[model samples]
Target: MDPSIVREIHQIVPENRVFLDLQERYSYSYDASFGEYLPDIVIQPQSALEISKLVKLANQHRIPVYPRGSATSLSGGSLPVHGGMVLDMSQLKQKCIIDRENLLAIVSPGVTTAEIHRKAEEAGLFYPPDPSSSHISTIGGNLLENSSGPKGLKYGTTKEYVIGLEVVTPTGEIVRTGGKTVKNVTGYDLTRLIVGSEGTLAIVTEAILRLIPKPPARKTMYATFAEFVTSGVAITNILSQGILPAAMEMLDQQCIRAVENFKPIGLPTDAEAMVIIEVDGHPLAVDEEIERCAQVCKEAGATSVHIARDEQERDKIWQARKNVSPALAQVGPTKISEDATVPRNQIPAMMNRLREIREKYQLNLFVFGHAGDGNLHPTIITDKQNKEEMKRVEDAVSEIFEAAISLGGTLSGEHGIGIMKSPYMEMELGEEGLRLMKLIKDAWDPNHILNPGKIFPQPGQTKVVLTDE
Candidate 1:
């Protein structure tokens, strides 16, 4: 970057906030996802006005501005692929006001989702978009990715709760979309458009999130199935019985063994699969729903059904589920996590496809996710340094996406199409559909200076490339 540009940026933000050192820029280079592209500079703007001015400067210089939060994206959403200015939005942590009267949370981009969850619960309310990485991931990133965890099966995703936003557009205009009221049906739903735009459409400085009354009581149960497909059958059975669990998470034998090996929780390693179900509401309703779920699991061929005796046991059960990602991370040097969602009934077939892909590529593949919502994360654990194995991993990932699309599924569920899944966007949305999306992107960011090299695939790019070679 030119010294003049740095001076201009420094004028907009504090000199201390401007990070030009390679050490600081390197920290912002890569996210949780694969690949790394160091940005030319990293700017921590604390206010919307500062960000607006910085964005204007970036647009004037044709520099790509990548707005990043806690960098917990699994799809490389925050990676500075274009190597320009990286806006560290985590510094914008001023506001996190709980509007109890309106059942809303007015928060800045830097606020962690866990903080919101904590405050909401304290206020006798609930904010249900609980991503696995909520403890660290910022609300800005969650809204951009529209992340949803197990509770999404019943409560819905981050976008559903985001009723309003204070955004800095790509053109450097600070604007407000929607409002505190949830019933607003204004002309264009720019809030929804920017919510899942992955920071391409605009940068969110603040947000108004809707909240619901906290459930009075909750019940949890875990069922182990002798056969993997039977576990999927049990899920279908539970849902068919009209029991809408707050969360329905499933783990394959690989994930089961991984969890036990990582930390012994007395989970049956020999079981082909395990399903954890959770329900909340009145105490009587919770008990009845859990019992019906247990009976359904037993009828669906569950080898064992263990209902949590109390809160401690319930947390222990949920802890086992939460340990999945870390446990799988220990399996190999690099973990290629992909959320290829399918229809609820097609889960068994999708699992079969993942198994075949794993065997065919000879890779360490494991499966787990919010099964109630049909979002299954088929992850491949491999060493990226191994060129030969990475080749196979690439092929396997492509096949996984193909399998999902074939089953009337999508390329992603919670994880957005940042760069890893960009090549397959057309495969799922078709050429015309993808073109319309591109039109929207072009209209929003004419200069393409905001979060470039993301979501949209480049010409001649047919598949994801993991290695520089």
Candidate 2:
């Protein structure tokens, strides 16, 4: 970058907020996902006005501008792949207002999802899009990825709660989409378009999120099955019986053993699979629903069923589920986590296909995810240092995507089509369909100055390239 450009940026934002040193720039290079491309400059804009000015400058210079939040993106959503300038949105945390009168929470993009949940609960309201990384991820990133966790089966993803947004367009124009009302069909639904766009379309500065009354009571239960197929059957039985759980999570034997070894959670390591189910509603309703869920599990061939006697027991069950990622980290240096989701009925078939891929590749692939919603996370634990094993891992990942699409599923459920999945977009969306999406991108960003080298694949790119060398 030219010294004149840096001086102009300093004029737009404070000199203290502009970071041009190589060390400071390196911190913005990578995200939670693998790969690293250091941005030429890192700017912490504290207001939408600052962002608008910075964006205008970027557009004038044709510099790629990557908007980033807390950097907790699992799909490389916030990685500075093109590496021109990184707009650190985390420093824009100024607003988080819970409008109890309208059942809405107006928040800045930098507010953590967990903080919104806490404030909403304090006000007798609920924001239900709880991704696993909510404790650390920003609301901006969550909206961009449209990420949801176990509760997606019942409450839907982040897009469902977002009613309005204040965004800076790719060309540096500030625009507001939607409004506070839930029934706004005024114009093009740009709000939904921008959300889940993975920051390619625009940068979200603020959002108005819809909230519902918190559930009065909730019940949790844990079940272990001798076979994964039996666990899948139990999930189908529970939902088939008209019992909609708040969350239904499944963990395979490998994950169970990993968690047990990590923290001694007392899980049944011998079991082929374990499931945790939770129902939330009126106290009396939840009590009856939990019992019905337990009976359904037993009928589906569960070897053991444990209903939580209290909140501590409930936390114990959930804690084990939460420990999965950390436990798996202990197994290998590299973890390639893929969220391939299918229709609820096809989960069993997908699970079987995943087992086949695991065995065929001879890799340590573990399976777990939200069973009720058919979003299974098939994670491969391996060392990227081993070129031979990484080649197999790459093939296994391709097969996994093919298996999910073949089973009438998607390549990703919550994780957006970041750089990792961009190469496979054509496989999922036909050529014409992909072309239409590109048209939208071209119309919105003519210069291709915002978040370049993401979502849309480069020429001749067809598969994931995992070897860093």
Among the numbered candidates, top lDDT falls to 1
lDDT of 1 by residue, 153-197 (tens): 999899999999999999999999999998999798989989988
Question: Candidate 2's C-alpha lDDT?
Answer: 0.93
Model 1 TM-score is: 0.99
Q: For candidate 2, write residues 1-469 as lDDT tens digits.
A: 8999999999999888989999999998888777778999999999889999999999889899999999987778888887899999988966899999999999999999999999999999999999999999999999999999999989999999999999999988999999999999998999999999999999999999999999999999999999888998899888888999999999999999999999997887999999999999899999999999999999999999999999999999999999999999999998888999999889889988999999999999999999999999999999989999999998999999999998889999998888888899988898998999999999999999889999998999999888875
Mark the 10 consecutive residues where model 1 has the least summed lDDT.
89-98
In candidate 2, position 232 carries an lDDT of 85
Task: Evaluate residue 81 in candidate 1 and report its C-alpha lDDT on the 0 to 100 scale.
Answer: 93
